[model samples]
Target: MGGVVIAKFLCMAKARKEYEAIVTCTMGCAFFGAPFKGSEMAKVALLYSSVFGNDAYESLLSFMRTETNDTLDEVVSDFMEIREKLVPKIELFCAYEEVPTDVAYAERMVNSPKMSSLTQHKFFRAGAKKLMEVGFSGLPGTHFVTKESAVLPGTHTIGLTVGHADLIRFESITSEKFVPVKMALTSMVQTARINARKRTSGQNLLSHKFVNQVRRSLEGVDMRQKFRAKVEQRQTTSWLTSEPQYQQWMAIGDSAKPLRSPHMWLKGGPGLGKTNASLAAIHTIGQTQLQEQQTESAGRNETFLAYFLCERSSGYDTAEDVLKNLITQLIDQEESLAQHARWFVPNPGYRGAASDDSLRSDLDTPASGAKATATVDNLWQCLQDMIEDPIVSSIHVIISNFHLLDSGESTTALLVKLREDAFSTVATPRVNHRARWLITSRDDQHIRSHLTAKCIAVIDLENDREYGGKVKIARQKHAKDTVTKLRQTKKYSSDLASYIRNSIESQSEDEKWIDSLCLLLGAMPNNSSSLTIRKWLREMSRYSINRLVDHARDTILSQNEDLTLEIDELLQTLTIAYEPPTLADLAVLTEIEDIQQLTELVRKCSPVLQIGEVSEDRNKVIFGHPEFRDHLITLYHGDSEQRKRYHGSMAWRCFKYIEKSYDRGQNGDAKGMRSLALTERIIDDSNVLVMANEDEEPDDAGPQVKRPLSVARTQSSTSIDILAKDFQMLRVSFSTTTGTSGAEMKAYGANGSEIFRQ
Candidate 1:
């Protein structure tokens, strides 16, 4: 009788497997054609079990009827028995309850230095022994066990039980509420064991791999803290205006063409706030989703979200890493999705109503001339599964720095495929389909050309009313607020606001200066353009324009001659450079060695020179606005010989400072190095070296040039060496020619190159 019951159970398991195979094959052929056979089999099985009731299969039905006090323990033992006895014969379903606790324990054990050094195979062996001692030591007649659990209590639970038929209940615990906690626990334990084994199995496997994954999981907390800190710091002075352009973007998204395709593009200069606006939109969407979930009391398991910053400079010259990272992020959010999201693999054909042998043969068929077709087919199938899966019903993806995909050569093919796939999958009208795409990039012609063909809506930053229109008004109010706050802190005089106002009003009459400032502002990238305006005032030695105006008003009241001298000196200093100097650099140039005195001077001249935010690293300074640098450069031509003389010493000092501070390994120092280059040219053209080196010239009567022979010789040698090195580094060569037109330089790489005649 026992043998008969066992044989019957085996036969049932075999039949279930066959049914599953048939259903899977049919579904693979026509995914939406018919209901899965497995569902029908489950229904039939449930009905048959209801009628049997311990008559035809007493031993089998008796195990199903028995209930254990500890479901976790029972399920774990049963799952182990199924794994051993059902292999190559039957399929079993199991669940466990204390899975989280088991995983936590395993993680802790693996991280322990004393035990972690052991290989995963050895580690699992040891862990299994430890788990058996702790969880199954006292339990009578228990053979094997596995476990899993509810991540959140009262949500769900599952368990399995297997052993001697008389010792276990197989029928009584079949209610939906009766979770297989032991099976969940066992599964989690086994998962941990398998992970540990993989981590420690071979020379390629390093313990750090597990440690790093754990570390990555903790990164979100760190990122949140850092983001909060940045926001707080910026909030102190940084201001944001109500942007109508953002509303327009929302409108565009709302009115987006109802094709089955997904497309979006935000175009702007660096500082135009495209990224911020996009992020804001995404946040709004997420909040909306949260509200819907709250109102419906439905779980958010069906939603998928991912953001990718393609501007990050990884080694590859393509967006593959960015795409992969985005996918990985999405997968990590829902682990089950990871299995369905296949990459870099070709598809197998539809197995529709095919036998197991036929399906296997089709899958094994070699890819010859149909490689591309096979690949796309596989990808389409995978995508179909992902979209249809109940787990990932809605997906939203945001890719930043879309300009990175504009490279005409390397990324063209991949971008084409991605665009095709994106449009093909989403743009079409499909019931219950939900997906959205957002992309941000500079408004370059290349990007516009590619995206326009695909019918993507492009939002231009320059014309964005939200950011561009309200900037001035917002800045003025922000300035006022700043002054008010400073006064409240007792950090400055109460009259500071009026002083700054008067000073700015006075500058309104300087048309030339204002025009220079405007030009400078126009030159800045969208993101940093506002900073240009601030930089102008800082360079003008006006740390606080309010204070400067106050002092001017006071001077007018007293009729002081010092004001005249100060104004002249300030103008002279300001007009000497095409760019603004840092407070430290200015102090050194003016011989004002005292930091406090320099600060005071800057404050007094704030109307002309705006003081901006200071960098965390005190070695360098930033202007109130990058536009101010443009203004300074536009107003003064340091190139003039006389003007260069006034700035020579200061320029040389700046050059030395930049040389000392620069880190060649990283991106070059933008301000310092560029400023030094300008100054060096000024110093070089001023004839200062020629004059200085004249005394060291040989007494012999040569051409009687101002420059010493040795100095001229050294300069020529240095120039030749520099030219040679530059060519060598660039894998190019240069040749010089002398004709009636004078010296001409021609550069040649492996391919044809350019020529520069000087």
Candidate 2:
């Protein structure tokens, strides 16, 4: 009991007239979660039992009654039985013992005594010692803490340890217990506050550096949030909800016998709910975590961690972006990580404590102008630390549409790194069994081979249930039932579902497609998100789909010279420009008029060509979908002559643009002529041009005759040179004094070489 607490009670008593009686107990009794005249330990022991009023107790009982022979469940039920036996522990609670932090009475506070700093300090030490005496059986070095153990409210654990020595010394005292304990208590607060502030400053120092690095990489990234929001924000009752894969994934949450695998690969084809599944997984995990957090007064240990969804059209398609953003979210979610951030601050010889200015120095650039930011290794180290943290049972990192990385080097390297994290056998992995990688991707060869090389676990939704027997019949029946349920809702119009299924050209993939189509059609029976439905509906409808596919077909196969300036330029432009090119960029690069011509060209290549603001400051024309882009790459890859012709077409566009510049002075004539001269010089060096020197003959009717020369330099992998040669006319219009045997023959070159014949 301390005078400081008595004053607080008196202050409160003045504000309220409900001070019927004063109750008091131990000064540091909040350690056992004790209340004034109440034992927290006894209360908790009773509540931890399956029969107790706690939500977790009830949850445990419900889980036990699920009737499972599963080893994990059996283990959990065994623990539940132990809890059941412990319900009798309630008998240990006393009606009037131990002090709650809330009601400190005058009797609890130190009374009259000779005031001295040293004597006051002694009482404060005993008070805190009493708190620790109740903590962990008070016997020290004998405790079983779960991996998911979290901080309870009003616990001064970290700061108390940092300033433990100072806590036992006091700057002031009153005449109580040889000296007043309240003065000592006041001294404890001042000292602890100083230590806590110092520790927080150091923690925030390291924390801000990590955050800045992550945010710098994600300057304007919003696609990840947008994609996650769409899926999570949608109605929960979808085809995905009822699926077995979803059920199996939920197994990740079973902590007693938690799934040991850190990585879960959700593989499927396009339109197979891979993205939707990622969203659903995030939502489900996050919701569960939030509920647990709400129910129990614990700090940042909630498990559904971070997710990154790759959308190629958005700037988020890059591997660097995904990794950085995921790390950022991890840091944001776990503020405790900041306390330990000094462990991950990349500065060499770091003492693990720094001031705000010292933090800037920690991440400062070197004299060589190289970055001092956290690298992959640093990020990896942080994740490893997070995994080792007991509060985090699992650090889940979900990535969707990994295939849309467009086979980038960043993508491949990132995948390999992720695979390493997934299956690292090191005693201390970046993320261990508790660290999960929930990924969704199409089963492309690159993805298959990369994952196979490392031997990771893959959950292919299409084959979630095998065929031929009870499984096959069940799946079929399930699919039919799903369709029936969906059909009852007006949202899943018969025309829409029929159109989607009937349009699929292959029958072998029908069962998988049927399930996917219906799942996508009616996410919920009636309350499927209007926004989601509208997006897919536009793409799923027969008319819009037909037009889109029609455009793709015409562009891929069109050889109509009339429509394409008799050149194969536009088609190649569509296939090869993997990076989006703005209309102005395309106009300049392709040498077409910027305004109407480029717009018309993109329109003609509709569906295949999508226009959007891909990057800041520039609107771009990019391929609408990853699958579509990959398909084009495959088509062009298979055909040799077609590829060469397109290459020639690309060069042709450049040549024609230079020619336009020369003829019309589009850019100043001097610059145009200089460009032309540069092209001719290259052509001359290549020595693959045709000479069109005139013969010793002159036209009988025309004043001057011109011959067009088409010449190409040898093949090149990067750049192709096309030259159209027309000799400059020398002023020799031979007005034939013409009766003399059909005019005399003459010849000339641009540099004037005249020839005569007898």
Candidate 3:
């Protein structure tokens, strides 16, 4: 018999949002009973309409109007294709059929105490009303109906039933109502096709949104730009490729064969170019990937590379930032992994695994605070899962400056786990794709303890004669390049250039010596004679880089007494800057109105700080080498309190600069202003934290009165210029020795009042 009555019931149930009942009754009526062929098709059409939403029905007419010329066979083929696409989208509809259908007892079960609570549910009330309308109205023999309920053979008829006339007669729409039958089938297939595509498109957009959200939260810096700069500068690590340790570390086997040693730890002293070596390995891997793509090999193993270069100056110092950066790189290589990371983007504080329940929990949990960042443990878990994905054939992870990571235990564990998995005695399918780690760092005790295992290989750059020779050669080349540039300056004559070149060659092995001599010779006044140049060479050759830096510090302090305060302020500002400030940035921060005077003062302090073009051709006054900076910091801020005091002084200068320069009434940058306000708050809070931890009581001098910009530069003992005009809204984060977590800064004003306290 036709399912006209069933279709009516489904429509009613759908109106009440009774999707479960519509799905259940349609499947039961169409599949169980000896229903007419046209009736079954009609019921299926109604099922698709109710489940797929109004758009599903509307799309059918559009499809039919455009496809009138298609053959019956072509139409059927198209319908089957659409059905295949819709299968995943309607899995829940199919699931309803598997429920045991004991229709005889369904009506009675509805009256049970267990169902009492559900009686108040919308679907229950809707069914109750239908039952009341069809009281004892069903066909007497085949179907049953009462004031409380109605029962059909194939479905648990809540309160709706077929009439006696509907049971006896079969309405064959295929024969008598051909148009209706054709329209029903066409609409059902068209609806499936349109809805499937719509759902897929919607899901794709949502997935991309999730990926973007996670990526933004990561705050990952692109190490590729830094890598490119190293390569462009001719800082080659090609020599590393020749080392036996390097050869073995970079070696890989087929999927069936395990990695002999997947972990490589490159330890060295500072300035040994370990970071460049890691970048070389990454560059080589990239070249190999490019070659593979060009070859179009059918069976080539896909290799994925994820790397993070940790530099404290760029805010990549914490273990959390490391893992987050690594995860970001991984997502870049395998975009689908972002779907996994999406679960944690809403609440990075949620450390649970990615599951339906955990995802719900993560979404439900609110972010802990305004600055709530991704947690290290959660990122670690996400990274581990990504590496283990079956689609990834091989993965190479390179982390440079591992020692710079504040909390590296999690990273250490991940490396260990990868190594163990690569060579595990117990074989597993997931181990088919293993991760290899190449870590470069100083010979820190913590790193040594973790990576000095029998299975891991450590390459000591300090003792490697070949590596040392390469470094010496590189240094000599750098010295020659410097001399060539100095000769071009015309400030040095032929004898002076030859003498400097000979001195550089003789001390190529002493990097600091070459570095110090280069700075001294470069900074020599144009009027200096050969005797003065020889005197400077004697002084440079007599002392080590450390002693030279100490001597330079003294020389800076021993300048004209009138310029002593100005020179000291300049030194302190340079020491506290995150990165070397440009001349313009320095001028604004130092409040040195005359660029000519600032340039002369910078040249006078050249032995301690040298002006050089660092990335992007921007000339900045930087230390000759990291060693010189270290020496200055040790000399001026050896004690933790002194360092905080300097930082506080710098924070105050940044606040003052923003206060004097920012004009709120004008159409100034709203975003920049907000950033400045936040920076001020962070500086103020940092000052408070610094004051709270002071070991001694403050003097009863109360608060120092505000000073004019001109007087403040010379009179304020704690004054240090940290605010560059361009970096007035720079991010400032500070942590204390008392184990307090880092907070954005706040500043202490002249009257001892806190500015931007919020």
Candidate 4:
């Protein structure tokens, strides 16, 4: 019908001789209409010529014609018989028809003399004008327009609207496959709908600032980066995926009715790779869903993957944090869910208001009275509403370290309620949404007792023989890989390398222990003689993980008294830290003024404190293995005295850092330190201060002065002074009814006399 299409057909036919078959088929197609004159045939022939240029299309039409007799009437009957089969052949034409945008086409129709002659009624004219402005693609819903009521069609267009039909067909095609034609049709259809919605809703609904505001209010960490780091560093094997239990679990999750067994509890001991396995499962689900989103089944169901990693010292150890985190993740994927959190906005003008107090209120603790309970209830209700939203197809939640949840029973009960909402009841044949939960935790009796849903599938990694075998194999492979690399780097003899490999493989199937052992082995001095390596390799298998850690610790501490003290300082600081500290923060906390000095200390303690690059220039320090932290804690034997000293040292260091930054006019650093100090509870109470004279003895010391200190962040503050007087040493203590009391500072004058007491 268009000059461009005719030229394209002529160009294609000239390029390929086999296109003559398409021309024949086009001629046959044109025979269905009016008399087949030469001029008339050219019009229909060119229209159908580009339907399909391949032999398959021609052969199908030929087969249908052969089924009928050679008579003209028989041919026409055959054409009618296969017309249904050939209807989809017009997809390309429909795709071409999308070249003119919906708005453009609407304007053309609105101004057409033919449409005016066909329908001059007021309603028809008005509807056409609306279409010109909004376009057929911009129609909000099926209710946007309708045909004549119950009698004659005097006031409106007849037949199903071409725009609605085109929209339905375009949506189906876009969801079903990735055809090049979809780019055009989807822009005219799907994108138009999205644009219409965007126009109807305020632009701020999708603003980055709005998203960040909601994210901060939830007080949840985005664990995607953390998981990605783990997944990148760890080498995964298919043994876990190939296991029967895992396969069945995956199958059920992939099923249409995943709610039948919505919860999967993966219970294992500390050293096992439960976290690793959970990461792998999340990765697999994410990849599968991403691939599915480009297939026919994509439109049938949508899947959202949300996960949380709970760590005890990371401050993400509460059930409330988990609910908030999952809700945040869900709402991030679906913005409509944010409406449920409207109550959280303390001020009605919060949309554009830049108020820090309001934002901080959202993260307040239970000590704040009824607001805490209200916040938790609101979060729980928001989570429930999200799960019940009909727009959501399925939500897969993968939570690791479930046992670490502070309020396990309450969290478990909330989870059970959420499961109920996702699942169908006898009264309701089915639920519109599904939620699949994959939880990993230690085999704690308390947690097991609370997670007793009949629908829950429990997989115990510790006791399963097959799982144990897989872990052993995976560890053995890991050992071989590590030894192969170490052999080359350490330049060991082939025999010695083989011996080291054998010793490593001979260790237990604990992934953490193997990793720790490998780290220690890698950290061994490359210049060490072959005999030394051989001796260490010989003793490795017989040594338990604790003994190995102890050996490493003693070796590092035996270097020198000052270095030993520095190492102790580093370890103590790392242990008490509320979150993993960057290298600069660690250096400040350890009181190591020199960067090189702190770097050396980190290297010496590499076997215990793992150093990872957070960025190109910044490094984060964390325990290389949980066993090492356990060993250190056991060695301390709950040394409350040393713990208090460590806490005091950290708090004082944070204060000093902030003070120095302020003195240097480094406002950014000062502000950062202030926030960090408050978050870590280094300067917790608002009205608290410490004062003492480290230079004088208690017998002749000056009067002790007490002053109320408020460490709450103030936007306009330029300088801060929490101490009443300049003192060589300060002591602060914290007491709580919640079993969190601790002595903070210990000070001794020149005569070694205790100068202050809380």
Candidate 5:
């Protein structure tokens, strides 16, 4: 109310100064979803959401460092506080409204149409108030101090009911077309009013004109449209692999058990179905929300927001890019918020206020245009503000190919911030009522460490050490499910469907071949898409199923123009990007012309390399799927000379990235030299092992760890002059550090000065 009122006041002030009509009784305010307080439903709803939010936090603590519990504890405490604050506000409003008796409220809620119904709101607000009071006196029926110990499941039916009621309501209506006649009439009435005001009011005195600087200041400003993902085109939710194990994960939002972790990290190797699982889960959320809308429950509304990072695409590599895209998507969902972006927009005219020197100061670049936007500070603030909005019940953000982010201070910091904000909740009665984040990444230790440190829920598809047998069973069932779904598609003829089902059911050995088989099926010829199951079976009858799949894989790798060459390129790139590369960095290396090119390549390399996920335009790439990477490495090592040649190419690229300021260089040169030297060694080493063995140089044997470098300082002019007279060209040597097998590097000049020593 304050923000809207201020904006209107500014408009009114302008109108008074000039004859223009700006502020009106009706402007942007349309619909608002207010959660109820003091009702039975509110108490249950708060508990269920809290439990669901904490589910992953508890489950994944063991996977993380013990110290993370402290961070996780702080987050949970803050969320409860949020609920407490909000419930009271909601109750104060509903107590004055015409709230119905509890029984009538329930019946009224069941029959409400749109989310704006008075009776339905009465129920939600009343429930929220009741829940808030319970928090004050201790859980309404129980006195357990610990959130975990309070409230039994079946004994408290309200938990389930409230869980169903707390979904956030955020819908974009500005995009809808308004009735033309109504709009014309409104415009005419406005014009008539303006004419009357001009005739009856002010004398046209001093010639003074003032443009509403606010509007001009934000000319062409729009953050909502800049970033979006083509998830629908990639393969709607149905394209996802639906296994029983995955089903348990998707059902977490509805479950009463407190989330062991605050968020879920869906871990998997490349191409093993992490994104598909995410998509499937997202689809399920959509369905759940749709059901709520249909029922007019006004209890809960879940809004899904996702950003898939692609390496070959536009701006997905950097920390800043991800933040911008995430914020953009959220704003796009709630069009009313678009106005706030204008408020944040810098007043361009203000630059003229400062002297030329200060205006020219480059230390802090003004984020005034499209190129400079979304600072780290404002990015998180914008998201938090949106999440905390009363109408936005719950925001579920899904980020796929999370490992694609280049390892750096910025990326790490951004991840930490995301983890912290995942716990921000709606105030007073429903704190868990705000947002939760879900990510999919390879099992990279660095990435894992950061998320687990925040006590995030982790569900690794490939990490099956505990229940291998059950996983195998699930895999078999998954394969059957795929076949069943495939049978219904238009591509499968009745005969082929029967034959496929028969072949699948008859196969005695469940070797966990579902994913591979699905990959093979997808990799089949373009003509295969139209091939009836009968024709496919007939073709298969000539050769065994394994042989057929092998042929298909070979065909994809060798004969397919669209896929073969693309896969070859992806294989080579991933092999060289052995360490993760920022999506933008890879794009430059691969010379990717557009996101479609990268998307096409990833599509071609499926079942082998998850390579990366490209967003609508920006691509974020990550190298993973150990098996796929190893296979590529084996091929790369297939010919020793080829491997050496590739290493040489990579070495040259690394050198290009190095800041070649010899005189100004200090410590950073050593780090760059080490990387360059290692690449050189890799090229020089004969018979390079795809998998390191005893024959390999001990220095380059194990996984590498990157240490953040100190800020490089310029050497004194006197030192530079003295060194220049005696110095020769730099010489780099890559060798093992004192205690680790990991290759480290050092650099020297002719004077034998340790120019870069680490």
Candidate 6:
């Protein structure tokens, strides 16, 4: 079967374009059951020949013309009619069997009335059933047989009788005569695979790219040489003298001897050059040590160095996992060190042991002192060995993130022990001259408490004058660019900018207005917290500002007349809700009569509302900020009596809106129906309905008026019925009080009466 499929694929590939042309011509005739002309069948045969082999094409053509007794017109017409009826049915069966799988093809068939009905045929039904039985069902819940069609026991006749025979014969002839074509397809697939592999291999890893970019950026400047030259050339007039922070940094190594420390802490905020300084320090130390090692290696033959980042992951945050990663990366980078650190690998046999005995055994093995002792110990022990070595002792170990090293008590204890072990060697006369350690951290206290040695140095980054000035300049530049971009948007600050520019450009002899506007903007407290800004904006509308800051402030504030009452109503409703409400809920509460009006209100209030995107629901709605919601709530809740009176009016307005929506629905407006449904949903929600119940009592009694009893009864009954329906829709329950006794109403039928009350 696979061979046959492959053969067909190869034959299709050979004359794919020609076959497509023939298929296109036959599609309409096949779909309508119309007879094909003699030319049509000849065309199909010609395409088949071009696709398979020339000999087969000619043979089929000759057979069609000479073997059959029927006239070409009759034969061709019969083929078309058979194909017209059969091919569509076959396609319908294929659709039912596989559901097309391709969404585009399925959608086309579904949209076409003829194609949809063909799939409803008995043969297609049976095919679907067979497919389901074979565990190849396309979608669940779709029934194979319906009242209109029953499953029949047979392969799809259209495909088996018409399409299958021709396809099989074509494949058989092609495989027998087209060996070279089959090889070409195989070669093409292999070539694609090779190209894909090459493309993947050529892509650079992010870390390598970062390192190369940074290296290229620093290629010309040698930090150690530069620093030395700067120190040598320094008089009283250099930029270092002007920059206090630069002076402090350079002062650390100003003396003949390098600044000695048991540990170091560099503390600063983001973009303060702490990282750059640390990298430069490491680079200088490494280059100096490597050069010395190379000179000694000419006589002793050995090398030493290692560098690795603590934080690296393809995806997800792994900051806490940096320690283990750093160790693994270091091992991978240095082959000699890796061989010595085999003890770090967990023993396969000891699955869950907590003790380090298995690892200790691997590390404790004895060999020549020069090579065996080269194995890593605690950081301090490694430092001690470096100090002891005659030819290879001048090793400088640099470690960063000293604060992140020991997050827990146990790890902290281990780190303290390692530090103690290293410093113990400092007491030895020879050890002091052989090795050095550089550590960087934000907290000096954390390191100090552990080390207990006054030898460690703590550098406060803020004290660096040059670094501070650079940071200030960077921030100002960033703020300027941010303001520029904001102004360019024409939505945020563009209008304000235009107003400012126009006010200045069109200023009459009165220059006071322009000066006052700038003063007001400057004194506007842009530095105020975001919450303060929102509060200030809400209280200072155009009219309100006109009363406070004269006409200038009023002119700065823009308003649209269309937004007047709608915006006020929306704000009032939001104030009542006391929380950011979803659009559906807000529309209900506000008794918004028109969806378009509600949409416009939301757009107008965008600046004051602080709208946020809906997280779960894709439905159009905006959430106000929590503080803004709180402010509205305060306004609504301040006067309980007035609030109740306001709510009553709102509820009555909602009732009228619902009636209008229903009238619109009766008049055959789908929009009105949707609005009615939404209003009904809101009125039916327990929270809103409960509020309505509270405000149901009339404030003033008047003369009794005759009401339609039947109409009243109908509305009362229908209200309860709608409530019950909504409860069911929302999957909730309601409590009913019957003569001072309450019962839980769980389920209700279409009528107003409860069916399940417990």
Write down the lDDT of every candidate, Cα atoms only: 0.38, 0.44, 0.53, 0.53, 0.43, 0.35
Choose 3 or 6, whichever is better by lDDT: 3
Ranking by TM-score: 4, 3, 2, 5, 1, 6
342-401 in candidate 4: lDDT tens per residue? 545433255334432111332233211122232445677877677766546677788888
Q: What TM-score would candidate 6 get against the native?
A: 0.26
140 in model 1: Cα distance from truth in Å?
50
Task: Kindly indicate the candidate among 2 and 5 with the higher lDDT.
Answer: 2
Off by over 4 Å in 2: 2-210, 217-257, 269-271, 286-300, 310-322, 332-379, 386-393, 403-432, 442-457, 462-464, 467-593, 610-625, 634-758
lDDT of 3 by residue, 1-758 (tens): 22323434444554465563343222112212222112212332343344334455634323222124243224334422332343222211100111222333445666778888987787656755454334212312322212211122222212112332232233565554234334444544543443343344344644666666678667545666666655664455656787766765565433234544676788887656676678778887777766654642311355678887775433355566677888888777656667657655643333333322111223223333213335555667788787766445577888888876644444466455545644552354434536777889888876676667766667888887867778777667667877887789846778888888878777554544565657656666778888988888866776777787777777777875678878877876676565567777677557775888888888777767667665742487776666677566556666644555555555455554656654533466543332222221123433332221111223357642322111011110111212222233232222222111111233333332334320
* lDDT for position 665 in model 3: 37
How far residue 461's Cα lies from its native spot in candidate 4, in Å, is 1.9
Tell me the lDDT of model 5 at 671.
33
Instruction: RMSD for all candidates, in order, please.
Output: 21.0, 22.0, 18.0, 16.6, 24.5, 31.7
Comparing 1 and 3 by lDDT, which wins? 3
Clashing pairs in 4: none
Each model's TM-score? 0.34, 0.45, 0.55, 0.60, 0.38, 0.26
Query: What lDDT score is found at residue 194 in candidate 5?
Result: 31
Name the regions of candidate 1 deviating beyond 4 angstroms: 1-261, 281-300, 310-318, 335-390, 401-408, 411-418, 425-427, 430-434, 464-495, 498-758
The candidate that achieves the highest TM-score relative to the unseen native structure: 4
- As for lDDT, the candidate ahead, 4 or 5, is 4
Give per-residue lDDT, candidate 1, residue 57: 51
Model 5 whole-model lDDT (C-alpha atoms): 0.43
